[model samples]
Each structure stands twice: as C-alpha cells, then as structure tokens.
Target: MATTALPAPKSGSAVTVRRILAIIGVGFLVFFAFIEIVPFVLTVANSFKCLPAVQAAPQAFIPLPPFGISCQTETGSVRSATEMTDGIAFNPTTEGYQEVLRQNLGKWFVNTAVFAIWVTVLRLLFDSLAGYALARIKFPGNRLLFFIMLGTMMIPGVVLLIPRFIILKQLGMLNTYQGFILTLAADAFGVFLMKQFFESIPGEIEEAAQVDGASRLTMFFRIVLPMATPALTALAIFSFQGTWNNFMDALIILGGNPDLFNLPLGLALLRGAYGDTLRWHTFLAGSVITTLPLAIIFFVFQRYFVEGVSYSGLKG
Candidate 1:
C-alpha cells in the first residue's frame, strides 16, 4: 500500500514578510543617503553662487533669482542685468571660487599636501615598525611599553597642545614645517591598529622566512609587509585624513605665519565673524577643495580600510 503524501510547505507569507522588511530597510537607507549627500550637493551648488545669492537664500538648494546676466553693448562693452524670474534658473557663477583662488589657496594647498604627506609616511613607518616589534619580538618590558603607549591615547589631545607648543618654542620649531610634521608623525592609534593586525598574522610565515636564512629586517620588510597591505592602507588613509583636516594644531602652530598656512588655517583666516556677519561662500568653497583629497583617498582604499578594521579586532 502507498503511504499518504506529506503536505507541501507554504512559503508565501514568509516571502511576503521578507519583502516587507527589505522595503523598510531600503527606505531607511534612502533617508540616510539624503541626509549625508544633500549638504555636499548644496555646498557645491553654493560654491558657484554669488555672495548676494548665498546670503539671500542660504538654505535653498537652488539659488534664488535676480540672476546677473551679462550683455555685450554696441560699443563692445559688457553690461550685466538682474533677471527676476518665477521659475528656477540655471544661471551659475564662480564668484566664491574666484574669491578663494584670489586668496592664494594654491600655496595653502601645497603646504597642506607637504604636511599631510610627510606625516602619513613617517607615521606608517614608525608605527608599523613599533607594532611589528611589539607583536613579534621577544624582549623585556615590551608589554609594558605597549601598555604605556596605549595609555597615552586616553589623554585628551587638547591637553597636550600647550605642552607641545612650549616644546616647539624651546626648540625653535614654532612657525616651522618641522613643528607640524613632527608633531603628528607618530600616534598611539596607529601603533595599536598595526600591532593588533600584526598579532593576527600567523607566526609560521615569519618562521618559514627565518628558516630560509632571511635576516629579521628582510623578513619584516619583504615577507611580512606585503601581507600587511590592508592594515597599512588603512593606517595611511587615517593618517592622511587626520593630518589634512587638523585645524586646531594648525591654528596653534602655523596661525602666526600666513606664508606657512595650510588649507585649514587659510579657511579660518577667510571667516568674518565680527558680530554675526560671516563669509559662508568663501569658507564653503575652501571646504569643498579641502574635502576632495579625503574623499579620493577613502574611495580608493575603502576596501582595505574595512578589512583592516575587521582583522585588527579578530585577534585582540
């Protein structure tokens, strides 16, 4: 005799529930996207707007009219007309950007580039070396040293500004590139990140290299470093971003020297904050310029950045 067939499983409700959840999740994502991207879009838009337009309609995504229209006169002279229209016009101007460029932002860009590049390179080198030693080397006080370095991270960075200033003054490094470059060259977070990453790497790889008669330095530079690309990329991105956007330290150190000012200090100098009047247009233009490098760096190395964070925590 044949047995009765089992009832078919019903998945319609389950599928419907999943679809509902997916729609809700997608809605939340869209909301967050608007929240983050709208400001940048407005900034880019306003950076091309005239000062009057910016001040008149600061919160508007589109600049309100009375737009300036240039017409060639019969004698070959150009005259501007203010057009007030009902609909939104696409009459864009570059006054804010022109103001920023006229302020000699190129020199500030170069100074920022130099400061950020050197800080990132040196931090990566010094932090990676210290991290690798702490992770791989067998020595007395190694743990103590690591703990001391980690403990320093807990102290507020602002608290050290005065002390750092005094030391730089005593050393005659104030208002010098050395002061900014050396101040941020090595940091505790980088050391911690790299050490955790190095710890996650297996010891067998290093041992195998050693067995092949490779020296310690060779093993580290050639063998291990290649494997730590993700961590290094993350560290480089962080270091570059931190150094590039460092406003307070730049203010404290390079504030007195306009010739040595970076983008942050330059932007600060552009602000007109006497009794509530401000220059938002020029400030936003400078901000847009300053944000480009960080955006590029993050977009390029975002993959490694995620992986590095994952591996750093895996062993710790």
Candidate 2:
C-alpha cells in the first residue's frame, strides 16, 4: 500500500491570507463604529440647526457659524430641494436649545437628576450588600432566593408596570420620589454581577481575615469590596445610565406629576407641548443633552472599566 504525503502550505500564502483577514476585520469594525456614531453626530449637528434646516437637510452634518456676523443667513435656510444635497454646511443656531430650555425645562432637568442620582446611589449600597449576602452567607433558602432573583430578571419590566403602579398607589408612594428610588434600588442583574465576581475571589482571603480576628463585616468592607471596584464601577455606570434614561417607570410611578417627570418623559410630552407639530430641533437638543453625560462618563472611565479578574493566592 502506497500513501501520498500532502504538500505543506507556503509561508507567503499563509501571510497573505492573514493580511486579507486582518483587513476585512478592521473594515467591519470601522464600518460598525461609523454607523453607531453617525446618529449621535447627527443629533449634535441637528440640535444646532433651525427646524426647517433640520427637516430639510438632515444629512447636512457640518455646522458653519457666520463668525462675527450672524448665525442666521440665506445659506443656512433651504428654499429649494436642489440645495438639500448641494452642500453639508449650514449656519449653526442656538434657537432650539434656547426655546427648549425656556419651556421650564430646568425643572425637568432637576427631576431627572434627582431620580437618576438617588436611584444609582441606593442601588450601589443595596445591590452590593445583597450580592455579598448571597455570595458569602449560607442561610436557609439562600439558593432559593438567588434563583428567585434570577427569575425576576426573566420577567419583562413592562409586564410589572401595572402591579408596580397598584403597589405604589396602595402604599401612597405613587407620584413620589422616594417610591421611585426604592423600586429601582436593587435590580437582579446587579446582584448577579456582584455575586459572580464575589465567587471568583479566593476563599483563602476570608480565612486570612479570620486568622487576623477581623469580623465578617470588616473583612467584607475592607478586603472583598475594595477588590470589587471594577464590578462596582460597572454597576454604578449601568445603574446611573439606566435610571437617567428611564421613562416608562417614571411615567407610571409618577402618574402625570410633572414635578417628578424625567427627561425622557418630559421630552416625549414636548411633542404635544408644541401642539400640531413635531419640533425635531428641540427634541434633538434634548437628546444631545441627555446623551452627553453618559457618553462622557463612559469614555473617560472606559480605560478603567476592566473585567474582574480572580485573585490567585495561597501559593507555596
């Protein structure tokens, strides 16, 4: 019996193949990044345009201010469809921001800030404690409680709105800030994240803390929690962003109380505030304002937002 040996792949061919794959991968990445960022860029640009300009040439993303003259100009106004695709430059205007801010928008801003900040702070404390308890403490029905939490995550939040509204009303918490914060204080995802990360920690650390006569609380706060900075930061970002942009919960819980309305809800109602017309520029302005804080925070902190790596210890 004769057996044939296959030819080995050439080094040049392998290198060519790798280069082609690398180019394709980078191309895909750039394409996706562009698409993701384009909406934000358009929002920022359109927020600075006149309503007519926004509706006329939305693709005109470049803003050109008539320096030392006036923001308003004939070039900025589109009189014909022919001009829509002719150029990308339009005179930038602050009218949208001015009008939106003038409509008692400051109050809505405060409301959104209050809701987002309080909820985020409460969630950090409650979720971390709950996570630590579940991850470390071996109480009766501990696994059962954790499983219940996981189950809750599977339930669509929209489905719970009716029940939540009824509960809040029965407790006289509806249309109240306290009720809003309490309801969102400890979400399951936060608990699950912290628990999984906590489990990754070496048990030897707890033993060492015990050897040093440190109480469980002391060891938890001083040792375990400190190491969980990565998870905590991630949790904080998610909580803050979610609460900041949360609309439905705010709407149902607050129940037409303008004082407690968040930015998202307020912005939605702004369409009707104008009556018989949609103000895209004002909407875009509000959107840009709403999106900026989260975007800035993420970009600045992303360098430090690393996955929680398990500690290797008790070595010889």
Candidate 3:
C-alpha cells in the first residue's frame, strides 16, 4: 500500500509527438527511395518507347503512345485514327536494342570485359606483392617509397592526363589496348589499400611459416595470402568498376579505334549530333545495356563490398 505511486500515463501531446516523428521518419525514407528509383524506372520504360513517343511525353511513367490522332485519305474521304490506351500501339519494341547490336555494342561489351578483367587481375597481383614487401619485408627505402607513392595520390588525376598521353605516345602505345592497360596496371590507391590490409595481419603467422623453413614466396602464397580474401575481393571489385567505367582515358588511348571502344566510349558515340537535337531514346537504351554488367557485378559481390566497408583490418 505504501509503494510509490505509479507513474502517470503519458500525456496525449507526448504520444501525438512520438507518432508524428515516426510518420515523418517514414515519409523521409519513402521520399528518398522514390527519388532514387524514379530515374531508373523512367530509363527502362523509355528505352522501349519509339523516338516519337518519347519526344511527346518524356516525363510519362508508362511508355504508351502519345495522345494524338492520325489522319489519312481513304476512298476519297478523310479518315481519322487514334491509338487507344490498351491498343497494340502501347506494346514495346526491341528496335533500340537491335540497333545497338548492329552498331557493334557487343564488340564494345567484350572489349570492356577483357580490359576490366586484366586490370583487376594484374592490379591485384602487383599491388599485393608490393604491399606485402612494404609491410612485411624490411628493405632500405621501403617506407620512403610508400610515402612517395601515397603522395602521387594527392596529385589531381587530371594533371596526369597530359603527361600520361605524352608518355604513351612516346612509347608507340597510343591507340592500342596495351596503351590503355599498361598505364592502369597498378595504381597507388590499390597499393595503399593492400598495404594497409597486409599490415593488419599478425607477424606471428609469417614467423611461424619461417620456422617451418618456408621461403618468403611460400610464406606469402601458402600462408599469409590465404587470410586476405576479404581485402583481395574488395580490391578486385574496385579495380573492375574503375576500369569498366573509365571514359576519358579510354577515349584518348583508344582514339578513333572503333574496334577497341568500351561501353563508355560506345555510349558516347551513340548520341546523334545533328544541328542540335539529341537522340535521347537510343541513348537511354544503350545506357541500360551498359549499366547491366555493373549492376550484376555489384549484386554478385555485395557481400564482399559490405565487409570491405566495415573492415578494420587491424584489431586494436
């Protein structure tokens, strides 16, 4: 009977405020989701529309025929025709996709795939070897070299474009795959990423391998490298995406070589530059095709991506 009085029921205004905040939070989430999803939806929808339909109502969610009537003379009398909403006119066509293939989109796809694969593979191997040496092997000037490489990252990428072009031209590599791939074989960022991750591995593991009479190469390949799957996956994804979407470098290096044009370069060439008006429908279709590979890669590797984001390689 003497127990403290039960707390009073929450005030109506307080309950109302909580409800309002919850509603507001949900509304914000929905709004942002809509913002992100709408453009993708519009692109896919419009990709199926004919040029005339897209021009008529670019903002329309559905790729239906434009609201207009067609007139033609029949039996010496004028007749009118209108496409109903549910008519065959609303059906989508594969013309854009067909045209893209005819214009060597498939060749571009293969070129981009091969280029990205080589970049990812070679970048990983070279970066990992350099990172392991810098992190684990004690060599004169190792720290200085790493710091110098890091300093390279601070240089604006644009500043290097002219210099890189000149270097490639001097080597007679311009307009070749070697010109494109060699310059990007290994980047400072990848080396830096691998170094940090390698440093996180316990030295005891390498020491154990040494005690077992393992050579440095054996220790790295058989022992240390096996524990670095997460970091390797992350690096591979980064390299692939960067190389796949590369535009300016590909444009310059592969200059005017239609056979070597990647998706980005091919998409750029898709635009029709007659006096002023742009061919938007065809452009959107090509964009959809180009985006599919990236989307697939991300979805396949999303688990590694998540781990990479939160990975603190070194446990403090």
Maximum-lDDT candidate: 1
Better of 1 and 3 by lDDT: 1
Cα lDDT computed for each candidate against the true fold: 0.78, 0.78, 0.77
Q: Name the runs in model 3 displaced over 4 angstroms.
A: 1-15, 56-89, 272-275, 309-316
TM-score of 1: 0.81
Instruction: Evaluate candidate 2 by giving its C-alpha RMSD to the native, one decimal.
Output: 6.4
In Å, residue 17's CA in model 3 sits off its true spot by: 3.4
TM-score per prediction, in order, is 0.81, 0.82, 0.83
RMSD of each: 6.3, 6.4, 6.4
lDDT of 1 by residue, 137-225 (tens): 98999999999998998999899889988998899889999998998999998999889889988899889889899998998899888
Q: Pick the candidate with the highest TM-score.
A: 3
Better of 1 and 3 by TM-score: 3
Q: Write the per-residue lDDT of candidate 3 for residues 141-165, one digit (tens) a residue.
A: 9999999998998988778889988
Which clashing pairs does model 2 show?
Answer: none
Model 2 stretches with alpha carbons more than 4 Å out: 1-30, 67-86, 303-316
What candidate 1 gets wrong by more than 4 Å, as runs, is 1-29, 56-86, 272-276, 306-316
